[model samples]
Target: MPVAAFAVVAGVIGAGPVIAAVQGDPALPERTAGQLLADAAQASRSGLKPMSGTVMQTASFGLPGLPEVQGGMGGASPTALLVGSHELKVWYGGESKLRLALPGRMSETDLIVNGDQVWLWESEANKATRVKVDAGAHEKAGGHPKPEEALPTAVTPQQLAQQVLQAAEADTVVSVTNTERVADRAAYQLVLAPKDASSLVKEVKLALDGETFVPLRIQVYAKSSAEPAFEVGFTSVTFSPPAAENFTFTPPAGAKVEEKSLGTLVGEHGADRGEGADPTHGRFEDGELKGKIRTVGDGWTTVAVLPVSERDLRTPDTGGQRGQDAGAIADTILKSAKPISGAWGSGKVIQTKLVSALLTDDGRLLVGAVTPEKLAEAAGRK
Candidate 1:
C-alpha cells in the first residue's frame, strides 16, 4: 500500500465538487455520530446492491512536479494517475458482475467482470486480455474483488469511506459535523480526527446518503490545511441495477486477445517467483505473511517497515522504454528526497503534506503518516 494509504488505512467537481453545491448545512433528520458510523459500516460490509454512477477523484499531496507523458490510452501513465482530476464510470450489476470504464482522449480502457469471466480492453492498443476468475479465490473474496484489488484504478467513495471508518478507533475523535449535499442528495457528514499530534493527517470526512446510508463522498484533510488534499466522490448515482449488457464485453474484431488466469493477471502464482521472491514484495507462507514486513507504533502514528536491497531497484527489462520511464520516476523521487542522518542511520527522507517515507542506508524503507522523526525512531528499532 502507498504510504498515503497507510496514513488513514487509507477527488473532484461534479462528484469532485464535494459540498460545493450545498448552500449551507442541509436540514436532515438528526443522527448521532455513532449511529451514522454504524449505518455506513453496515452498508459497506453488506452485499452491494446494484448501482451505477460516475466517480471523480482529485489529489493534491503537494508532490514535486513529475514528467508529463503523451495522452491517449497512455494517459493511464503512472505520473498522470498520481496528480490530476480523473473520472470513471462504474456499474455494479451484482456480486458477480461489475464494470469500470476510464475514458481518455480518443481512447478508453475498461475492465468488465461477468460471472467467471473477466475482460480487460484497451481501445487505443486494440487489445484485450481474457482471464478466468479463480473459483475459490472469487468465492473467498465475496464474488468479485474490488477494482483496486483486481487492477490499478481510482477508488470509489464507498471503498475509501470503509477504509477510513475502519481506522477510526480509540485514537480518533469521531463526530457528526453537519449535513451536506453530495450528488444533489442530502447526506450526513461524519468527521474523524486523529488524537496523535505527530500524524500529518488532520481529519477524514465521509458523507453518507441520508436515505441509504451509503457513502457518496469522502475527503481527507492534511494537518494545518483547510482544504482537502485528497477526495473522491460521486457526481451522479442511481440505485437501479445497471443494464445486464453493461457487464458483457466482446473483444473487437481484429483486436489482439491474450488468455490468462487470475494468478497470472496479478503475478501471484508460485511459478512466477522463479528461484526466489522478494520478501518486501510480500512472500506468503501458509496463507499469512511472515517476518518480512512489520508495523511499528499504533493507530494514526503507525509506520510500516520493509526490508529492501539493490535487487528491489532493478527492473526486469532494463533496456526497455518502460524501464527507462520507471528509472526516471525513481530519479525524480530521489531528487526530491532530502538527505538525513540520525541514530537510525543515514539515507534519504521524503516528506509530503500527509505522509513521510525513509529509505535508510542499511536496506530499510519505513513509511507512515507520522513525522520524519517518528519514522527515524521506528527505523532505529531492532
Candidate 2:
C-alpha cells in the first residue's frame, strides 16, 4: 500500500481534552462488517487525499515508568511515546509533499518531506539533517516515493490499522460495533477481537471515516484492562490539501546542517534487496541489529526473535552524550525486566499489558503479543 507517507509524525508529551464520542451517534448509513473491511482495505491501497490534522497518542503500558531523558532531543525521542499523552501536527499534500511538527514546551522539531528532499530540524539543538532521497532507488524498494525507508521504524494509526486488519483475517472475529464521530467527521467503529486466548490483546478498534473510509482512530485494548493500553487518533482534521509552503523548509542560519543520501543510509544494498530476503543473513549496520532477526508462528501469535550480543548491550564510545543517555536508558529497562528461566535456558522477560519480550542469556530476544509461555515454546523450538 502507499502508506509510507503516513508515519512521518510521531507522538510528543502534552495534554488535551478527551474528544467526545459525539452527543449520541451520527446517523450514517449502516455498513456491513465485510463491506467496511473491504472498503477500508481498498482505501488504504489507494491512499488518502491531501489533508492536515492534529494527532493525539496516549499510552498506558502498565509497566514501570521510563526515566525521561533531558535536552531538546528528548521530546522527539522514541522513549517519549511509550507513556503519557502527546500531540503532533501533520500536513499531507500527497506522498511527495508532507510535514510533521512535534511541539514542546520551549522548542519544536519538524520533519519536512518535499519532493526528494527531506529535512529534520530541531530547534532546541539548533541542528538540521537533510536527507536526499533518490527517486529511482525509492521506486525500486516500493512504488511509493517515501524516504522514510532510510529512517528508523515507526508506526502510525493508519499503518497499524492495515496491519491489524491483515492479521485479523486469520485469527480474529471482525464486526461493526457502532458509529463514532472522530475528528468532527462521522465514522464507523470496526472491532477485531482475537480468537486465541493466549494472546494478550483483547481487541483492536478502528474508526473509519464514513465518507473516505480512512482510519481516523485506532485503539488497542489489553486483556487485563477495559481501557486501551495504546490509542492514537486525529483530534481535528480537514480533507483539503495543505498549502505548498507548508512543505518547504529552511534551516535556521546558525543551525548546523548535515547532508545525507539514501545510499549512505542503507549501505551498498539496493532498497529493493530486502523483500522476502532471509533476515537471518542480514547484516548489522548504523546501530541497527540486522542479522538474527526472524519470526516464529503465524498471525496474532507470531514471535519475532532478535539477537543482542554483549557488545550491543554495552555503552558505545560514539554519539557522545546521546550514546551515554541511550545506554543508561537501556540499562534501566534491563534492570526492570523480570528474570526468567526454563528448559529454554535463562533470560530476562519484560511483560507489558499487550506485549511480552524475553531477552535470553544466549543473546536471543523473543517478543510477541502472545503470553510468555508462548515465547518459551517458541524458544524451545529448533
Note the Cα lDDT for every prediction shown: 0.67, 0.67
Q: Give per-residue CA lDDT, model 2, range 47-164, as digits (tens).
A: 6789999999899988766655544332454566678798889999997898999887788878899987798787877878888877687567777534334223325534433443
Name the top TM-score candidate. Answer: 1
Evaluate model 1: give its TM-score: 0.75
Please give, for residues 228-313, the per-residue lDDT of candidate 1 as tens digits. 88888889989889998999899989999998886776662232222121233223433333667899987778899876543354
- Per-candidate total of colliding backbone pairs: 7, 0
Clashes of 2: 0
Write down the TM-score of every candidate.
Answer: 0.75, 0.73
Query: How far is 226's C-alpha from truth in model 2 (Å)?
Result: 2.5
